[model samples]
Target: MGWFSNAPTANRIQNTNTIAACVALLEANGQVLNEVNTFASNQINRGQQLSAQAFSVQGAGSQLGRELQAAIGSLGALKTNTSQQLDELGQLCHNMELLIQQFDVPRGARTINASGRDIARVAVHDTSLVLANLLVLEQNSRPDIVRSVQTIDRADTVLNQGNANQAGLNLPGMNFRFQ
Candidate 1:
């Protein structure tokens, strides 16, 4: 019969329920973020495929050149859209991290007895550390998307250079010419 035993049991139950609810909410937010990441990844793959097709037609004549140009334009547009979506997703994840960090679980009960036996008391777990770790993981994952976008941009540059070469262009100091 310690000070904790004086607190109402109902209040202890309510505090436990609140912690469970917060865990569930955080999990839901994580799932949404995962879905957004999957979408952005798919878009990056599509852009890569389109870029490959465009580059493949670089050495062909006028007809293939026109087709390659069109493909490049389409892929560029897709990359732009995907980049925007990823930025939005990153912002959402940051907001979720902030919310999870601010969650406070109040102390409710400290002692309980079962069947006329005193159970060993354990301290309450602080979940803020776990939530902060999850936020760190989310932040770590963002760089991969950013790198993919940069890679796509580089691929675009390679395609453009190949296209220029096919058109008999040469750098100012280069002895080699496409023609």
Candidate 2:
């Protein structure tokens, strides 16, 4: 039922599969970080625009302008720290993937790795887009939440296919390093 459930050869193949999963995880995390950055930038821009409007209409010395300025200042401080933390996380995930790739992998355990990753990557892309769009829906702007839901459904389908593949779908002509 599992890669490590068999023997040493299976262990090696499992390690290779683990590395593939690590790559997907790292890629997903990177996309998330990029979305965070976009969110922060859009938020800062919105705050600035709001502040400008308040100042122009209420006068630069007005109480509304003063309050908006303070809020924007706080957001600025938070963005600096938030972006730095996200960068560190991205670097750590990248390094982890690299480390995992250094391990040797036995043949015949590699099955549809790229296909699985493609499925996961589509899900990740849609997820980030949904999050970012939700954050900045804008004036009377609407995003189709259903699309994200459908992507999640596709991910579920991919998961089921992966389970079936792992269960007993061994290829006949290939040499399996692990029995």
Top lDDT hit: 2
Question: TM-score, each model?
Answer: 0.37, 0.46
lDDT of 1 by residue, 1-179 (tens): 32334343565455445545544544554455455445454544545464556646554343433443444444344445434544544554464444333322112232222211111011112234334444554455444444444444444456555542211121011111111
The 10 consecutive residues of candidate 2 with the worst lDDT sum are 170-179
lDDT accuracy of residue 99 in candidate 2? 45
Q: Where does candidate 1 stray beyond 4 Å?
A: 1-10, 58-130, 153-179
Off by over 4 Å in 2: 1-8, 105-179
Per-structure clash totals for the candidates: 0, 0
Error of 2 at 93 (Å): 3.7
